[model samples]
Target: MASMNNATEGQHDPATPLFDAVSHPNSLSKQVTRFFGLGQDRIENILPGTPFQRDVMDCAAKDGQRAVGHVVFEIPQDVDTARLAAAWKETVHQTPALRTCAYTSNTGDVFQVVLRESFVFSWMDWTSLGLKDEVVQDEAAAAVAGPRCNRFVLLDNPDTNERLLIWTFSYALVDTAFQERVLGRVLKAYKDAHDELPRQLETPDSSQATPEEDPNPNPNPNPSRILKIPQVADMERATQFWRKYFSGLDASAFPPLSPPLTIPSPDAQAEHRISYSSPIQRKWSSTTLCRAALAILLSRYTHSPGALFGVVTKQAPMLDQHQLMMDRPTRTVVPIHVSCAPDQSVSDVMGTIDAHDHAMRQFVHAGLRNISSTGDNASAACGFQTVLLVTDSDTKRAATWEILKKTE
Candidate 1:
């Protein structure tokens, strides 16, 4: 064997070199900073921590999480575009967390605007208002006048195919309490924007022209029935808690998910009676554990795995099939169906669902896109389904979730 020459090697520090450390900001991080328009440094400083955030954190602490919330509205013909824009602008002005025009560069893009976290915050405030109390009054002591409620303006710009609107809360507001307290005000602004124009803004009738009627009629028709879902609790003691709270009223006698309203799938029907103790509970925490336990009970009773049964997440849009759902706000309804393969065990299915929950945790952290933006591919697994939704977090407050079922 030939003798090998020994060379002295230089030692290097373990730390990454400046050139090697330059990594791109993740999609989520970029989105948060860009949509909110906060400097990359301030992204976390002004983020809102409401029921939505609470839900996310709770799920993140564990291995999985699952819950859904939606807002709906009615879009009237001859909608008032100007007022709507003004109203949205007003919401931006009122919100403290987003008082800054954090993402001015991308604000004009509909996709960016729609997914902007600040926009969702504004819409949440809009949806929280009660029918009767449309607008909230400005507290004189706070030195801030109430939000400048205006109509939501939906107009087609030269660039975009979908309609775009400017509502309040386009920017950041510093006060969290003020933000929560003034949600009603933000909604009132949207309502005002929606109602600015008369139901029918008629143009001058043509004196000489006769209009032709088309024989082709609308292929899809609206449903004639209104669905009512009864509020049921998962636990006996919890049911009793609600019963005692509603002392004079009988909670059990509440209406059921009516006919002509079949659930999207048999699995979704089970979700109808399900109750979650911590709406924001993580997938692996006591809440998920409890949910899994209940699923086991359900499996034992129904002779099915958790995969055979799934949860139906509900979404209510501002506009329904034909017109604006006058009963609610204007927004999109998204139902995220969580089910497993038929052959899986209850525990196995639960594990899969838990994985989905964890994915969502990472998803939200990665920044969120509007359900609409997720495209048709996202909802292909489950079409439309009815669910029992809790309008109020108290569990006692519930409503029937009716999806506009159509033969497409």
Candidate 2:
């Protein structure tokens, strides 16, 4: 269980004193330090044990105790680290949750790990609940905070030129219910101080939604927009809207070959594929179309329509081959499979989407959840494709079809 490597003295243990000071008694930090035999000198870029850094850690540790949540902000291509650091510091002074914030790095440079104000506490006080006498974290000790989680090191990702930031928050502080609220505020603060929003692969416009009068079905072909929906409200209305749309579709207008249309694997990686062809000539996003198809099937069995997962739409501009390599390699698409009860109803679909998919996206984007490709058959049942829908506006007018086709 020893993690230290004698060949490199400082390289093995990256723990800094400031990190230990901010995180004590919870055993997560202490465990990491003792297990790795970390050294104070291992943290080369930023000095260890700085007051500012301790404050920031304290803030994050506090928030961690609450329900779990996560936020991610892109560092724009032209962002200036010095300016960013100053803005962050200034914001901390003004914000109540961030008043205790300080730098976590040694050299006074902007460290990759950015902590939010509310994420710095212990989750579920045992004594408060009248349970055992154990306290999650005692709020005493100078330069030290209680109820802190174990800290992890950031590894440089050369491919995307970005550092991976990872840590955990309690299910109490940041769960599906409050994920959007916390992350939205955090990202907005970062952007207000920075120049612009971090560039996504595709950006969808809220206004461009087909005007109620517009005859054209597809307003933006390359539609990648994030839609924010509160967890509890409007369950029936949302379900009805999508259900009616799908049910109204003229199934006979499109080519119907069999129960499941199988496509030859386009590339070597795919094992099988499903195809849905429509005849209405109305424009539809490939992603939306596939999701709709799945929704249609789901409705038949469960009597409810499927809804988009959290973050409504998370897309980056369609990156050219070169850009794809240069930018972060975060996988935007995650596979989800749900088995509805035999008598499931629309209420169930709405409830599930709200509680699970939409809410889970926060953790994925925040680096809390690990997202990867799945080759299992279950993903196929849930409609997995390689080529995402391209916007109609971006392509030629032959009723441009931007569909995501899976490779072999």
- Candidates in order, TM-scores: namely 0.26, 0.21
Candidate 1 at 104: error in angstroms?
A: 13
For all candidates in order, the CA lDDT equals: 0.28, 0.28
lDDT of 1 at 337: 34
Q: Which portions of model 1 miss their true places by more than 4 Å?
A: 1-147, 150-283, 286-335, 364-376, 379-382, 387-408
Model 2 gets an lDDT of 0.28
Q: What lDDT tens digits, residue by residue, belong to model 2 across residues 312-355? A: 23422222322211111123333343334447764554455445
Question: Which portions of model 2 miss their true places by more than 4 Å?
Answer: 1-84, 89-233, 248-408
